[model samples]
Target: MDVDFLLNKGKTIGLEGLEVYMVETELLNLTISSDKVREVSSSKTFSIGVRGYIDKRVAGVTINDENLRVDAAFEKLSSLIKTSVEDPNWAGFPPPRKGFINVICRDNRIIHTDYAETMKTIKDLMEIMKDEAIREGAERAIVAEGMTRLGVQKITTANSEGVHVQDECTVFSTFMVLKTVTGKGESDKSFWIMNRRFDLAELESLGRDTARLSLMFGGGRKIENGEYDLILMPQAAVGIIASTLIPAFSALNILEGRSPLRGKLESKVLAEEVGVSDNPELPLEIGSRRFDDEGMPTSSKVLIKDGVLKQVLHNYYTSSRMKLENVGNGFRRNPSSPTTPYPTNFFVHPGEVKLEDLQREVKKALIVYETIGQWMSNPFNGNVKATATHALLVENGEVKGPAKGVLVTGNIYEWLGNKLNGLGRETFTSEGIVAPGVWVEKVKVATE
Candidate 1:
């Protein structure tokens, strides 16, 4: 595709500024069902997105055209711009910037791996799950379904402002849901693992854990409704924090008065032991990137430090609208979509509190492994209400039994502030949220 041609054409057509974003992706996929290989396939896609500004009226168009239909895209964009209302705060597209930090976003191995290798990985993972289930005395367990994906994407951003940048990244991820039957009942659990690099050993470990947990959650019984101290595993902790607290740190939400964290910068919003950051420069993580979609350089920054709200995330639009410096957090789900503020890789800093020691110290806490309905959490008012689908009762520093159908509800501010207990010494990342196990005191738990 000729980006220069698009920019020159837009100028001749009376457009003040123009931007072109292109993505080319190649993906290899393998799906499993009922412990059998359901499908194997490969695909390649080319997408083009164009955004233009005409006298303070901006419009964009996105198309999956491998042939590069410049004329059609421009016609649609022109029509949309003419029908759109002019924005008083409209600014031109961002110019090119330098000093982009180096981040490990690509893995050559994933790109080179073939279909046979991916299928072998799936088979190995299933065998590991079976072995783990047998060791856990639940040999009746079987893999209900799963998928493995290896993909590489090439992203190019070019605009009339003389900004042209390109990036390439690779991703390998897999997930499996295991189901088991026991004398009491049937239970199922799922495990997901993703990274820039592919490693079968690591996937095997996750598979084993999934199998063990599925068995543990079998024959679950309800606990009494009352206040109990809680210990959240890394997955559960990430789920709650990502849904309840992370969105509130976006400058877009703050400016629009849709965030509870508005006007709280530099304030002590969480416990002193709590800290959070957005570190896109971290190596081998799937979200690691050196530049955002707008060709802005990316860097690691602290959002919360020593319990104080240190920095808020910003994209170019939000920061410019608020008259604040752009921190390079701006991203778009697609090229034609408006830029929004989002963390590349959000992390809750780990602490020195060991999980075993913390569990022993809080002997009667409920250990929550996974949750559902977290997306229903309200970020504007900081209200969190989610059901703990996989949890266990712990007493005297030992697992008592499975506790299911537990409804955990609370306000985010209260849970991370006064009710906070401690954070585990180790950290894990799932779906771009890197966090340690989180503990809170006297949390309200409801059951039927």
Candidate 2:
């Protein structure tokens, strides 16, 4: 952790320029309930973050391992920049730069896994969710809950402009919660998968597709509100465009005016069959990163091409206060957060139609597959409400079954402009963007 002697000990404690971020973690957790495998855990952590600047006033600090000494993180970044407040767009940190794109975000067999090989892959994912909830007949199914997590991280960065850097990654996620019953009653469903590698046949096809979609919500109903044509699924279209159109491509929400793509960059604004990108060299996606959180690097951009409005998202202090060109997406939602303009891997471009040929050109749709208050969406005016805790109603194009709670509501510029309709060419990345399954048209649902 000698980030070059903690940036030369913050210039012998006077603090003019310094930065040193570090994180080290290793974790493993497993849980499942009432139907067994109740718990197993492990963890290791250490954190240290510090930023300093004197006259220009910037400050930051985070410490653990009992104030991981470096003079107690530069005396708490010199008493928080002595009552901070003086950044008229202070530009002092970022310096080192290089191509850094080599991706494949770690997964050496989950760092040589164990715990009896992840408890025999969670008892073969609960015997493949009890043989697919007894071939979907379910007169009482189980796997009532689940969880599995494995993590590893290393990250480090230095500063005072010589800008050092380091990185390491690994993540594997899983979640389930099947539960079913017959006589037309109980049902519960939940499924999850996250990556960076680890696949026991895709975690037993995510416990046999969450016991066949929780027995197709056994006799579900309730659907009657208004304008339809929805479809969504790629986890509800990456959870309503990553919570309402990716924070309007934050360049600090377009320089504080809370973005609506403020001043609309290259114009257009969504739907020439929509396209988007941010790609940190794709590969084993988990928001692959090379250098950010201050040390720069990381590239690949094109925030929307056919729908124009190309590029928006920066980092080093919003590209040094909007002077542009810092595509590294700064990021830092912890380690004493600070740097911000996010998005490292964010694609959306996919189409060759197929999700039953885009739900056979919709004739009354709904599909959505799970959502809940999509973060009470509203990226400043690109409104969108959520709550379709699992849907599926389509009519002419088939599947007239499940529906629950519903609600939806829209407006990301009229659902990506003029009710955009068509997207699925099979893509998936969940909770970190990489989408597919979209189609829009009408929208505005509701129910009882």
Candidate 3:
């Protein structure tokens, strides 16, 4: 699309390379609470982001003048980069793309899961929770809020390398957090299910069962502090491992004085069973992209394959500094961090054990029904101290009483490197990882 613009600009003002990249994102969200649609929102944004070279002066700009008058914005951006400090490490774009893989193979028009479908899904989910409460003693269940989001993005990258590609991506996600109130006590449960296409229908059971478990722990009591087997759910695993573990393997974060695994590539510092990889080109991943933000083709980089410390996530800049190649994980959470690198839908290979089997194997481990303050963990040290909610007492390898008033404290690295023992049969598909449930040998827990 911008090939014509770049070529025209080339004739007017000769340059080594000229590129105009455009990214279009459309989001449709539906939020409901108590069987009533609270909000229906739709939005779209187009960014005419350009990167080009003019006599060793690498300039870049994103034209966001929404009134279709972005040409002025482009001129302003083209002039703004002239004032930037010369980046000696900056490199031109990669070779032209050979071809493209239609990541969004399905009909993009059907990607939006509207309020009607989303509300129906919630009704079914509530029914499951109501059934669970009937098993208990609660008369009725109220969902504080239930929501689903559908997003579609079209990315076009055209550069002087004879590469012109446009790829479409769509992601569907649903999240629910509910509280089950009883005369004994009230307990809360949070659940988030996401995928490239799987929406609320794929999460009915999870939404219901998680809420059911919340009601079961209404009257929680305190327990003593000792080493017990710790059970992790897949979403919990992503919240735990994906948060801390990412720091050790982030090449961009490493260069920014943030990553812990700055100098430990190809080293065995983690459990042999733990593995993580990035393949956004994966069949259906929320974070998958045909090319990273900088137009680098994404690749399959093994970060912790079979716990051997194979490699770390990388982008063009970090790869050049480390004297390696790009792996296409350039993460740009917002415009402020365009070059920032992060994980796509990171993959964690599950062990041979099944979810039910893992539950049976843990004879007396305390299944941490929920953990608090995962975000508070210090990735530099992996030190985490948090309270446990809906913590269940699994006795003789069977879940016993739904315990409460418990707290967990430990370093994630030590917890995963030494305390972790078996992988669960059940795996969770989330925005960034397909992590499986993992069992840890011991954790310091205190009951109130």
CA-only RMSD, every prediction = 1.7, 15.7, 3.5
Candidate 1 per-residue lDDT, tens place, 1-448, comes to 7778878978887888998888888999899999988999999998878899888899999867554677787888899999999988777788888879989888777878898877877887898897788788874978999988888988888888988999899987888899987665788889876778787777777888888888888889988898888888888888888898888988989988999889998999999989999999877787798888888888899899999999999887787788876657878888788777889899999987787676667657798889999889998888989999999898777888899899998887888889987889877786678989888888899994
Worst 10 residues of 3 by lDDT: 98-107
**Which runs of model 1 end up more than 4 angstroms from their true locations?**
66-68, 396-398
lDDT of 2 by residue, 1-448 (tens): 6678877888998887888888888878888886788788898888978888888888888877766666766787788899888977888788888888787888888889988898887877787887788777888787777888887888888889788888888887877787788777888788776767776887777678778877877777998899998878676778778888888898988888998889988899988888898988776667787877887888888888889887898888878787866658887887766888878888988977787665666789888777878889888888999888778898778888888788888887787788877678887785457888877888889885
List model 3 lDDT by residue over 1-448, tens digit each: 3447744664355557766677787877778686455888888888766666655567665565454554564565457556656767666555654433345333343375665665566567766765676566665566667787777777776667666766777767777767677877676677776677654445666865776776767777767678777777666777777667776677867777776676767777768877777766666667666676656666666678767777777766677777775547665544323355677667887876665666677777777656777777788767766666657788776767777777776777766687778777677777767878877777877775
The residue-level lDDT of candidate 3 at 105 comes to 30
Model 2, CA-based lDDT: 0.81
**Model 3: residues >4 Å from true position, as ranges?**
1-21, 51-61, 65-72, 75-79, 99-109, 112-115, 135-137, 160-162, 198-201, 225-227, 255-257, 335-337, 354-364, 395-400, 403-407, 446-448
lDDT of each: 0.85, 0.81, 0.68
Each candidate structure's TM-score, on Cα atoms with residue i matched to residue i, is: 0.96, 0.39, 0.84
How are the candidates ranked when ordered by lDDT, highest leading?
A: 1, 2, 3
